[model samples]
Structure formats: structure tokens, C-alpha cells
Target: MDPAKLSNAIENVHRAGMPGLFAEVRDGDEVWRGAAGVADLSTGRPVTADMRHRVGSITKTFTAAAVLHLVDGGEIGLDAPVGRYLPELVPGERGDAITVRMLINHTSGLGEYLPYAYPSLRAFPDLAECRPQSLDDHRLTRFDSTELIEMGVTAPAAGAPGGTPGLYSNTNYLLLGQLLERVTGVAAEKYITQNVIERAGLQDTEFPDGPQINGPHSRAYEAFFGMIDPPRDYSVFDMSYAGPSASLISTVADLNRFFGLLLAGEIVHPSSLARMQRTVPIVSQEGKVIEYGLGLYPMEAAGGGIFWGHGGTTWGAGALSMIRGDGGRRMSVAMNLQRWNTLDASGRPQPHPIDDALAALYRVAMSG
Candidate 1:
């Protein structure tokens, strides 16, 4: 790898307005790690390669791996209706029609709970007197999965169960988390930690049970909808609201290790891993074309080829982990800022700084 090119990529991320960013790349026996910007803007603490960050939806990959592990063990059937495991949680009719496969592949058509749970203060009659911010006051409150599911269950369904195109809803994985517990008699966190984290030997990865990140971590900051005067310190918010959907915290090294091992067929059985790579085209709400597999995503590599992994976004953090399919090359990127959208007046997303940063990083990481 060219050091100059790699350094330029890291600098590009900083220039994109990310307070801090870190990344790890692995090709065969060679490993490259880099960090730029401040981990804590207040203290001017620079980000380091080993610093942990909230890897939002990337947690879905772990959750999906756990679910697939159950499938491999015959404890759970992929084609079986999720209602078979948690009948009381899902809507009576819709639950019966949705299969575990649909949930993992994001074809369940379930609504997201966050919007309902934290609607704009102006929209909620009872909270009209409260601040306009959605999650400001509830940041520290521990939420129950059941209540969160109920919020989705009551919201308008995105489409008929398994009949619509891929709709990325955290509700799908939230229910899967409940299903994992129902099947294995273990919490989703424990199952994933044992099956995925431990299996991959990710020493710095964990499913934190509280608001605080236990080890060395970047202070997460969020400009909620870009409305907050200054980005709020959301590094300490209770992750229960995100639960099995987006609660995993990890470092770039650990993330790279996990994805590397996962694609190498060490995390799940070959057959199960193959199934996880089967994907469906998904156009994100922002109109980006994504191909989502069971818990993984196929990103078009800069040098031509597919890199499989997932990207995650929490309120104050963002993460990306991808491994080339043809070779074992892997890269993981993390940022300490969230809601960093640059939208036009029509609310359409324009390319943000992270896009340029990621493109630069990918060019270097995937280069031979």
C-alpha cells in the first residue's frame, strides 16, 4: 500500500468535516491502519486506530449471523414464519406471513419504530410543550424491546409482508433479536457475542449493556437532523433504543477482523455464509443503490469487483466494513459524527464529505 495515498485518504475524511475518523485495511498478511481528526473535539484528543465507535446498523450483521447460526443448528428455520417463535410480538396476520428470511433480507415490510417513538415534539400533542427535538430528552432512557416492537406494530405497515421490495426497517431485526432469545433461551447480545465476536477474536468489540462505552472510545456527537445549534454529546445515550438492530460498539481493527473472518467462512458454516451473500437490490431512502444480503451488503469496489460487508449509522457515529470477494482484502472505517447529511432544498441528499473520503479510502485499500 502507498503511504502517501493512504494518508491523503484519511485527510480527505477530515476535510469532509468529520470530527474524527479511523480505518483499518488488511490484504493477505499485510495490514495498514490510520486515523485522523479528533476523537474528542472538546479535549482535542486525536482518534486512534484502536478507539471504539458505535457501529450502528453494522450490528445487524452480527444479529444476522446469530440467526443463521441457529438455522445451522436447526434451532431456527430460515423459511419459518417469525410468528412461530414470537407470536405475541408481531401483528397476528402479518406475522404469520413473514418468514425469518424476510426479516434478515429486509423484505419484511415492517415500519421503523424510532420515528414513532420519537416523533417531532410539535407533532405529539402531549409533548407539544416539550422541545422540538425528537430524541433529546429520551437519550438516557432505557427502552424495552417489546415497547419498541409495539411502536412498529402499531405504525403503518410499509407493505404486505414479504410482498414488497426491500425496505430497511430496524423493526425487522428488532423482532429477530426477540426471536433469537425465544429460540436459544439466551439474550441476543450473549448469542452474538459468543457466536460472532468471540469466533472472530475481536477483543475490542462488545455489546454494551449501558449508556457508557467501557473502553477507549471516541466521544460521539450528533447534529440531530442538523437542527441542534451545536452537535450534542450523544456518546452516552442508552443503546437500548437501538437494541439488536444497531447497538454494537467496536473498533476498526475488530471490525476488520470480524468481516475478514466472516467472508473467510470462519464465522458461519459455508452454506450459511453463502446464503448470507445472496442479495436483493435495495434503493435506500436516499436513492442509493444497495444490494443487501442476509446481514451483509455488496459494495461496488472502486477498482471493479464486489466487496461484501455492511455500513452502520448511529446518531453520532458511522461505520463501514467491507472485504473483497475475489481476494481477502478488507477495510473498516469509522467516524465520530452523525446526521452529517448535505441536503438540498428539495430534501434530496447531495454527496457529503464522507462520500469523497470513502471513495478515496476505497481506491487505496483495494489497489493492488
Candidate 2:
């Protein structure tokens, strides 16, 4: 891979509308890091390669690996029902049917609780109605995971348990968090921090205890599907609502090390890694079809090659970390902007330069 070409791709993202972005690529022992645009548009602070950023749903991969670590040690069962562990949270008929496997793969049929939690953004499948009140109101609110899970479980099931074309739901991951606490005798975040992050030797990765990120980082900006006239900075926000599902603060270098180790069986046992790659069809929040495994997904690259990783976004921060199937090449990127597209008259997202730039960036990052 050409570092100059990769660097040019990142610069294009900013020129094409991204507020800021930082990325790292690994081709064997050689490494390249690049950053573009201003991190804080107001202060004009530039982004850097080593800065910590909220990596959103990539946290799910950590949670899933920690759970599967228990499986490797015979502390948990892959197919065991969550109700067996947290009956009070899951309970009754519904709990009995959905297995741990289903939760990891988002096939448990639980509906997403986001719409209920953020009533202002409840008009799902319709980005045109997006608003920022709930996000603003609860910026520092520490949410109880159980309360959040109940909002999802009690609402309705998107499909039957083990059904094909599963719906992606954060509720399932919240339940897994509860299960982690029950089995580990510690909070899910703590267990994952110890077992996964520490084990991966990722010094720059951690689950935040509160709203503030402890080190240097970019100011995250959210557009709310272009409802917010000017994208608002949400750099400091409580992540309890996302819990073990989405709240991870990390850097690009650490992400590369972690995902690389994960694919090489240095973290979970090879057998468990196999299960993590066993995919099922999932209908994402935006109604896009993605092949999801435990927490990782198999992404088909430009040349029909496969890369395993996850992409995630919070109010204003987003990231994607991916490693080639052979573990020979890797890419991890963190961005300061989220949902930058404006909605069209038909309530569909109008194409923006950011999308094309990002698509081009990934192609270059993954190419040889």
C-alpha cells in the first residue's frame, strides 16, 4: 500500500465535508498515521494521530470477546439462555428462548429502545424528523442499564427468536452487560477493561467512568441528520445509556493492536474466534443489510476480499476498525463528526461528499 495515496484519501474526507478525521494503517511491521482538518472548528485545534476518540459501538466487540473468554474457561455457555443468568432482567417466556448466541449476534428479536429513550428522535426510518432535545437534556444523565433494557424488552419483538434477517438492537448488548456482571462479580466495563483491553495490551483504550474523556481528543460534532442547523459539539456526554454496547474511548494505534491480536487468537481462543465470525443477516438501524457475527462483521473489501471489524457512531463521534482476513493489513479510523447528511424531501438522506470521500478512503486503506 502507498502511504502517500492513503494520506491523500484522508485529506479528501475533510475537503469533502468531514470536520476532522484521524486514521492508521498497518502493512506488516510498517505503519502509517494521518490526520486532517480542524478538530474544534471554533478553537481551530488540529486533529492528531495519537488522540483518543469515542469509538462508539466498537465496544460491543470487546464485550463479546470478554463473554467468550468466559466460554473458553468454561465459565459460560455459548448457547445458554440469558434468563438463566439474569432472570429478573430478561425473565419469563422471552428470556427462556433467546440464547447468549442470539444476543451476541443481534438475533434475539428485541426491538431497539433508542426511539423510546430519545422521544425527540423516535421517528425511526425517517431521519427528517430527527431532533436534539433528548440528547441535550440527557447529556450528563447516568442511565441505569436495566431501565434501558426494560424499555426495549417490554415494548415489542421485531421478529421471533432465532429468526432470519435479525434486527440490530442495543438492548441485546445491554442484557449481555448484565450477564457479564452476574458472572464476573464486577461491572461489565470493569471486567472487559481487565480481561479484554488490558489483555490486548492496548494502553490507550478504556471504558470511561463518567462524561469526560481523560486525555487529549477531538471535539465531537453531531448534525442530527441535519436537523441541528449547525452541528453541535458533544465532546463531553455521559455514556451510561450505551454502557457496554457503544461507549469506548480509544486511539487508532490501540485499535489496530487490539483487532490484530483478536484475529490472531492472542485474545480469545481460536475456537471462540470462530464463533465470533459465524455470521447472520442483520437489518441495521438505517435499514441496511449487513452480515453480523458476534460483535464483529465481515466486510467485503474493494477486490471482493474480506475484512472483519465494526463501525460505530455516537451523537457526534464515530469510528471503524478493520483487519484483513489474513491479519496482514489493518485500518482504524476515528472521526469527530456524525450524521452529516441532510434529509431529502422524501425523508431520505441526500448524498453528501463525506460519504464518497469515506468510501474512497476505505478502498485505499484496504488495497495493496
Question: TM-scores of all models?
Answer: 0.94, 0.98
Q: Which stretches of candidate 1 lie over 4 Å from their true place?
A: 121-132, 285-289
Predicted candidate 1 versus true structure: per-residue lDDT over 213-322, tens digit per residue? 99888988886445655787788888998888999999988888888778777888989999998988654544455778898988887668888988888878889888
* Candidate 1, lDDT over the whole model: 0.82
Off by over 4 Å in 2: none
lDDT of 2 by residue, 1-368 (tens): 89889889999999998989999999899899999998899989999999999999999999999999999999988898888998898889888999999999999999988888888878775777767799999999988899999999987788998997999999999999999899989999999999999999999999988899989999999987787768999999999989999999999999999999999999999999999999999999878988999999999889668999999899899999999999989999999999888888888888999999999999999984
Clash count, predicted structure 2: 0
Poorest lDDT segment (10 consecutive residues) of candidate 1: 123-132
**Which one is best on lDDT?**
2
Q: TM-score of the candidate numbered 1? A: 0.94
